[model samples]
Target chain A: MFQIIKNEWRFLVRSRLLIAISIAFVSILLLSIFLGNYQTQKQEQTYQKATEHLRQQWVSIDAMNPHSAAHYGTYVFKPANLLSNLDEGVNSVTGNVLRVEGHVQNEIVHSEASQMQAVSRFGKLKSALLLQYIVPLLLIFLAFNTISSEKQSGRLKLLVLQGAKPLEIILSKTLSVWLYGVLLLIFVVVVYGILNFQNLTAEILTRTGLFFLSYALYYFIISGLTVFLSARWQNATLALTSMLGIWILWTIFLPNILMSSAEKWYPLPSRNEFQSAMTEDRSKGLDGHNPSDERGIALEEKVLKEYGVDSLSQLPINFDGMRMQADEEYGNSVWDKHYGSNRNILHQQKKSFQLGGIINPFIALQNTSMGFMASDNLHHQDFLLQVENYRRVFIKMLNDKQTFGGSKTGNWGWKIDNAFFKSVPDFEHRPTQISVVLSNYIMDVSLLILWSIVVIALIFFGTKKIKIV
Target chain B: MIQTIELTKKYGDFTALDKLNLSIKEGEIFGLLGANGAGKSTAINMLLGFLNPDSGKVQINDIDATKNAKDARKIIGYIPENVNLYPYLSGVENLDYFCRLAGLKYSKTELQDFLASCGLQSEANDQKVSAYSKGMRQKVGIAIAYAKKAKVYLLDEPASGLDPLASKELSILLKKLASEGATILMASHDIFRVREVCNRIGILKSGILVKELYAKDVSANELETLYLKFMQN
Candidate 1:
């Protein structure tokens, strides 16, 4: 069996067509890796510049009202890790810069897709695109004729006469072709390792290892199924056509249709509807700015009673700041209700998309690639949640300064020094740890494994009906 | 030795091979002459364990080819009408690859000798098979089978489109294998070549063996007349 597989490799290596194709393919893959790395590095440089520049401005602020400082918000730039060079995933569509201030929770803005000219439907020439799309297609083309060509050219009969069982021959040929895809994937991974020799981490290595494994599994499925089909059918043309049809269906048509279906099944509210509903809920709470309103008057009375003062002038602390802090807490609840529901909808949509992987493993590959690279919508949402949490902390600090900084009631002229602003912690985007976040990708991994099992089973069981004649 | 007992095959409503039986012993070359769809290839396919007989059994060297085709194929060698090989591989490489498939290993020099001994030129041994003529490919194909030291050779249409010189070489090679105590079953359209090389000949018409005779008893012209008469009926 091993010798038969070696012979298959010998046959493939001798073909000038294979050599030519390999040269072209490797050159393109290297170019894609270089470009993806360059783009990610440029993004890193931009983020560092923006972050440092924003912090510098914050440190230089003079004395100002705490609420005034809240209005002058700072922006937090999302961090791009090394693996983003492989699969940008939702990174291109989800903007990286998020504003953290007071009152409203701002959406991250300035996505690469929005900023770039809309020309290529296939985005940047990333390594993920080539490894995910082109490599498997090449494997299919090579494997689709692995057995049918022999059967059609009358070599299968000769080989069978030479003492090779049909299943053994089919499996050896399939492995020979599958190894081609694994080799390509390994080349990319080794290149990635070399490029990040100084910066390799446990998370990066684990993700890269799993990335390679996922693609290897996918490649085997492709080769196994294609070779099985080649043997099952009588001619190379029919086998090639059928495999091509499957490729198109799995990678192209089904993904879009399923994503659309998932969205329709677990739909998210429109932007306007979401904002208006949040606003309607917020209106039911006390308006912090309106001191003369009924809720504010009631709050003012309660605070005076607690402080044992007869009126506003008798109060020792700033009642306005106290009311503002209370209002901010109420606003946080409104943000949670709306954002939490949206997150749930997105999760449902993602789950549905993942379930679709049982039918098409390509979906699993896409999701796994994005997930491991921390570039999927889930990761993006995690970034937003972290930023929102930071915002709560940031605004509370400002509100507390006003409420307890020896400022009396209605003393709007009270201010804090730049020292307070400098002491306030800067927003740093801490991504969720891999150990905590890995559960989200379990379905993708299982689907990929299931796909591998099914294809291998088909190859073994289907060989019985190969029709060597 | 090669033997088939009441070998029969059917394709839906058509009887492809109907209760056929043949016994060819060692050191004998038997030729099967037939029309285009006369079940000659079908019989060759069955003997090679390529297709199952709907109702029959094939034995190669006394091993049942039907119940255990892989084991039976250990002693069988086959060359099809076109002798398909890896077009990108050299003659020697193709021989070595197929030999390895049959679990036969040889040094480079031994592989070259096998090709050289089978009448493939030394220069052509290293040249890719894509550039080889039909005769050269047949030489390598025979070398693959010969290197295995097979006990039986099942050939289908072995001389359909070869030049006269190549056809003569093929006949000589078949005779050489028979001389070495290998049973050769060849199916062909070339009547003169069949009479020149075979010890016995059988004519098949519409999946039935219509006539059988010794090559020594019939002249080439008489055999052709007999085959034509069978085709007309």
Candidate 2:
């Protein structure tokens, strides 16, 4: 087996076509890394400038009412992961800038895809695209004729007569092609690492390493299946065509059909419907501006009783602040109920997409690749959750200041200095741990492992009935 | 030794090999003479453990060929009509690869000696097989068989496309190998060459062995007459 593999490697390296294709593949990977880094740097610079500017504006503001300052919110920029260079995932399509203000939750805006023309939907020329689409095609081309060619030319009979088992022959040929793909993947990864050595973190390294594992498994599946087809088919052309057709089905057609089906299966509410529902729910709750509403009256009465005051001005703290805080609390619950349901639907859709991996392992590869890179929907949701939590904390601080800063119920002129505004913490997003992120993609990873095992088993068992003559 | 007991093969309704029995002892060269689709290759394939017999058994060196193909094939060497090898590899490399597959390891010098012994030019040893003539490729095949030290050699039309000189050279090589105690089973249409090299010859027609005779007991004209009679029937 080793001798066969060695000879195959020698043959592949000597072949001018393979050498040319390999060089082109490496060049594409380098170009993807450069483009990714350039985009990331540009985004980082823009966000850094925006954040600094916001901070300066906050510090230079004149003394203003704490409630007014709460209305004037800030922005949180999503940080770019270095692994995104290899697999951008859904980041290009998703928004990056999130606005954190009082009273209302804002969606992240300014997605890169939204700014591009319709043609960008075909996707960028990223490393992930090549790895998922082109590399597998190349692997199929290399492996589809490994056995059939030998059989066609009558060398297979000689091989069998020379004490080489059909199983060993097929396995060795598959491994040779798999090793070729592995080498290409390793080269691209090494180059990517060298280019971003400065930005290498533990998380980045782990993600990239796992990325290699996923792609290696995928390549093995491709090679094993192609070689098995080669052994099963009588001629090289049939084997090549069958493998090519499978590649097209797996990568090109199936993913789109499955995604659309998943969306139809677990449809999400449109933006208008979602906003209208939230608005209706908010209206039914205590109106923050209309303190004379029944809910506000009940809150005021409870606060007065708790303070042992029967009159409007007898309370130690401002009644208006208490009412506003009550209203804000109700609004938070409404936001949670609506957004939580949306998140659930998204999760359902994701699981639906993941189920496709059982039939098409390409889906598993794409899911795992995007997931580990923190560019998928799961990571985006994590960032949004953190921003929402920050919004709550930020609003609570201002409400507390307004109620306890020696202000009366009707004192609309009450204000806090810059020192107090500075005391409130800025929005800092802590990226979810790799372990937690991996939990969300366990199904995808398991499917990939399962697919690899199945393909290998099929090659060994499926060729048992093959007719070498 | 190579032996088959009532070997038969079928493809749905078509009988490829009939219940034919034969045996060849060590150090003997047997030739199977037949026209196209007479099941000559089929018989060789069955002995080499390539195609399973529909009803019968094959034993190679006293090992069950069907049930223990790998072990049976260990002592066998085969050269197809075209001797198609990895065209990108040099003659020596191709020989070395096949030799390794047969569980034999040879150094470059030994490989070169085997090729030279088979009448291949030393200069062509390092050239890719893609550039080799048919005769040169057949010489490499002989080198591979020699290097493997196989006990049984199977040759399918081994002299078909070769020029007269190359065919004569192949005959000499087979005779020498037989003299060295190697058992050879050659399937060919060359009656004169078979009469010259084979110790015994079998004429096959429609998957059946129609005639069996010793080379020493018959002349070239007699062998042709017998083969033509079997093929025409």
Best by DockQ: 2
User: Per-prediction TM-score, please?
Assistant: 0.96, 0.96
Question: What is the clash count of model 1?
Answer: 0
For candidate 2, list the clashing residue pairs, or say none: none
True contacts kept of each: 0.95, 0.93
Question: How big is the positional error of residue B170 in model 1, measured in Å on the Cα after superposition?
Answer: 1.8
TM-score of B-chain for each predicted structure, in order:
0.98, 0.97
| Model 2 agreement with the true structure over A138-236: per-residue lDDT tens digits | 899999899998888988888887877889999999999999989889988898888889888898888888889999999999999999999998888
DockQ by candidate, in order: 0.75, 0.79
